[model samples]
Target: MGNNKSLRDMQAEVDQYISQFKEGYFSPLAMLARLSEELGELSREVNHFYGEKPKKSSEKENTVEEELADMLFVVICFANSLNIDLQKAHDAVMHKFNTRDKDRWTRIGEEGEDENGNN
Candidate 1:
């Protein structure tokens, strides 16, 4: 959810930010560990908001969107270090989903109306 930039553009921005640092991207293992940590943070937020669990008064609150952005930054760093194009990766997965699950779910308008209660 960056404004309007493509994934490639986002990758370039991440690269520029990382380039300023003396130590660039972390090792792959470290990147994975960081991703896991961010994911856990996001999960905790989700649990507090939507699940039975409640956040403790001492705990700080973070939006799910912010946690997702943090994870995305780490992922972009990982992909940039490996010279992988996330746009291509995302497209390939979307292609698979479109082909393999073309009819797996019903469309909102297929039932003669949109999900928004519109005609």
Candidate 2:
């Protein structure tokens, strides 16, 4: 379950897996709903583990890590269905954050200076 596969590889893997099914991929709206559902499940796990809420004995135990993987699977499926390259998307997002929001947070080591020596 744990590997160093890139986003492109993950997308291909999901595509291959979904290709075997007669239903292939769901509509974007349905996938969006599934993504939301997975997010809710992840949130519930977080609340149960970190917040005041505790799981009852009758409830099935699920780890936050597992919930995150479930959400990732749905995301990969959504991206594959839409012909979107998540690697490029991730790179664009990182570039935006690095440039537009670089100064939005405080640096760890120095005042008014980031780890990359940018002031």
Candidate 3:
């Protein structure tokens, strides 16, 4: 959560995570499917939030948060298997945008506009 760590560090953490699993309980394809299911759950929350779909009757249930965490867990597990540092990957994309497309998505604060100011 603080900063990028080496692949070795990520690998060690992944090894510890795998230690808790029973042998051959799941496969890569299964993990991907699980990830997809989590994404679908998250999408439902987005739909409800945007009024494109009705909110569930169990409003107290935090399905969205749980789904998001589920998606992240699988994503990190996938990246760990592929020997990718999620933080490093994230930073690389951010750097690319900062260097190459800094102005591609201009916003009011930078555009010298209060065009839609909510004040």
For model 2, residues 3-119, the per-residue Cα lDDT tens digits are 899999899899999999999999999999999999999999999999999999999999999999999999999999999999999999999999999878886676877568778
The parts of candidate 1 lying over 4 Å away from their true place are 109-119
Residue 17 lDDT, candidate 1, scale 0-100? 92
TM-score of each: 0.84, 0.90, 0.66
lDDT of 1: 0.90
lDDT by residue for model 3 over 1-119, one digit each (tens)? 23685545655666587768776224678878878888887888777776577876976555667878677767777777666777788889989999888666756565654435443
Clashes of 2: 0
Q: Which candidate is the best by lDDT?
A: 2
Stretches of model 3 off by over 4 angstroms after superposition:
1-15, 24-26, 55-60, 112-119
Superposed on all Cα atoms, model 2 deviates from the true structure by an RMSD in Å of 3.1
What are the clashing pairs of model 1? none
lDDT score at residue 61, model 1, on the 0-100 scale: 82
Q: By TM-score, who's the top model here?
A: 2
**Positional deviation of 41 in candidate 2, in angstroms?**
0.4
Q: Point out the higher-scoring one by lDDT: 1 or 3.
A: 1
